[model samples]
Target: MFRFAMLTLVAAVSAVGAAQAVVALDPVRGATALAAVWREGAPPPQVQDRAAILKSADGHYWAEGEIQGRPVRFLVDTGATTVALTQEDARRLGYDTEALVYGQKVLTAAGEARAAVVKLPAVSIAGASVSDVDAMIVEKGLETSLLGMSYLGRLSGFEATRTSLVLQP
Candidate 1:
C-alpha cells in the first residue's frame, strides 16, 4: 500500500507539475495524430526550473528558478509595456517558431523596435500564474528579462516602501 501510494503521488506530481504552463496547438488534432507524432519523434525536452531573483544581494539576478523551470531574469522596467523576452530566451523555451504568428511594432528605450508577439502557453512568476501572456520576442540587446506591466499589472500591484518595492502579486 505504501509503495502504491508513493508511486501514485509521483505520477500525479510529474503529470501536473508542468501543467502550470500549457501549450495550445491551433486547430486541434485528434489524439490519434498526437499519438502518432509521439511514437515517431519530437524535439528535445526543454529544461525547467524555479529559483529566486533578489535585489538585496546586489544588482544581481539568477536565471535558474523560473516558474516552469525556464531560465529567466527579472527586471523592473516601467518603461516597458509588457513582460518581454530576448530571442535567446524564446529559443530556450522551444517556441516552435515555424508556427509563430507575427504581430506589431513597439517602441523601446533604444528606439522603435519590431517585435513578434507570441502568447506564452503560460508564465508563472512568484507563485502568481497568468496564461495566454502577451510577450515580445526581443530583437535587440537587452540586459535582463523585462518584467513589464502585462504580467505585473495582472498581479495585485507593486508599491515602494523605504528599502524595497513591495510586489503584492
Candidate 2:
C-alpha cells in the first residue's frame, strides 16, 4: 500500500512539472499572463532621455560642449538665433580668425558687431549632439561662446527651471 501511495505522488508531481514545461514553451502566452499579473501592481518606471545644465553663479545656464572633438564652454542663450563663438573660442577650435569673412552685421549687447557665418561639422553637449550646425564667429563684443537656437531647436524639447535647464533629445 505504501509503495502504491509513493507512485501516485510521483505521478502527480510529474504531471505538474509537465504542465509548467508546456507553459514555458509558449513565450507569447507566458508574456500575456505576466502582463495580466503586472496590471495589479504599480506600472513600471518609464525611461527618460534627458540632460541637465545647472545655473551658474553668474545667473546663467552654462554647458561644457565639444566642437570637432575639442572641449568648449558655452553660455546657453535662447535669445541668440545661432551659436555664437567668440574669437578666442573659434581659434581654440582651429579656426583661422583672420581668414573668416566677417560680413554679417549683428547687434550685440555692447553694440553692433560683424560676424562670420560658419557650419560646424558636429557639436555635442552632455548627450545631445547635432551635425552641420549653423554658427557664427563674432568679430567683437561676444564675451563667451553661446549655445543658441540652432542647436536647441533640433532637440525634442527643453525647459528652464530656477536652478537648471533640462534638455530632452
Candidate 3:
C-alpha cells in the first residue's frame, strides 16, 4: 500500500507538469491563458522607454517640458550644445533676470548674445526626466526656449523621422 501511494503521487506530479508543457506549446492557448497558468492570472508587465513627438508644420520638433513642476515649451534643437532658455521664460520660472550675470557669450540665429549659465534642478519631458541639467538663459535674440544636447545626450537614443521624433530613454 505504501509503494502504491508513492507511485500515485509521482503520477499526479507528472500529470501537472505535462499539462503545463502542453499549455506552453499550444498556440491556441495564447498569452492570456499562459499567464493564468504561470502567473496566477496576472498579465505580464510592460516596460518601455520610448516617447514620440510629432513634427510641427514649421518643420521643427517642439517639446513641452517641466522645470520645477512648471510647464515650459522648447524647440528641439539638435545643433545646440546646451539647453537654452529665453529670458522671459527664465523669469516666469522665478529666475531674476536682472540679478543673473550674463558672462557666457553664445551665437544665436539672430546674432551673438550674452547668456547666464544656470543648473536646473530637474527637467522632465514625456515621463522621462534628467536632474541637475546645465542650461543657459539667453539675454537676447532668442525667440523660443531650446531643448538641446545637454538633456538629449543623457537619453539612451533619439531619432527623427519625416513626421515625428522618437526619444529612447
Tens-place lDDT digits, model 1, residues 123-163 = 76544556667666655534345555566456555443222
* Candidate with the larger lDDT of 1 and 2: 2
**Candidate 2 residue-wise lDDT at 124:** 83
lDDT score at residue 37, model 3, on the 0-100 scale:
10
- Tens-place lDDT digits, model 3, residues 92-163: 999999999987766555656778889999988776688889888888877778777678768777766556
- Number of clashes recorded per candidate: 4, 0, 0
Per-residue lDDT for 18-89 in model 2, tens only?
111100012234311100000011111222577777755544456788899888777665544578888998
Over 4 Å off, model 2: 1-48
Q: Is candidate 1 or candidate 3 better by TM-score?
A: 3
Model 1 stretches astray by more than 4 angstroms: 1-67, 97-103, 107-112
Give the TM-scores of the predictions, in the order they appear: 0.54, 0.69, 0.69
In model 2, pairs of residues that clash are none
Q: Please rank every candidate by lDDT, starting with the best.
A: 3, 2, 1
TM-score of candidate 2 against the unseen true structure: 0.69
Measured by TM-score, how close is model 3 to the native structure? Answer: 0.69
Report the poorest 10 consecutive residues by lDDT, candidate 3.
Answer: 32-41
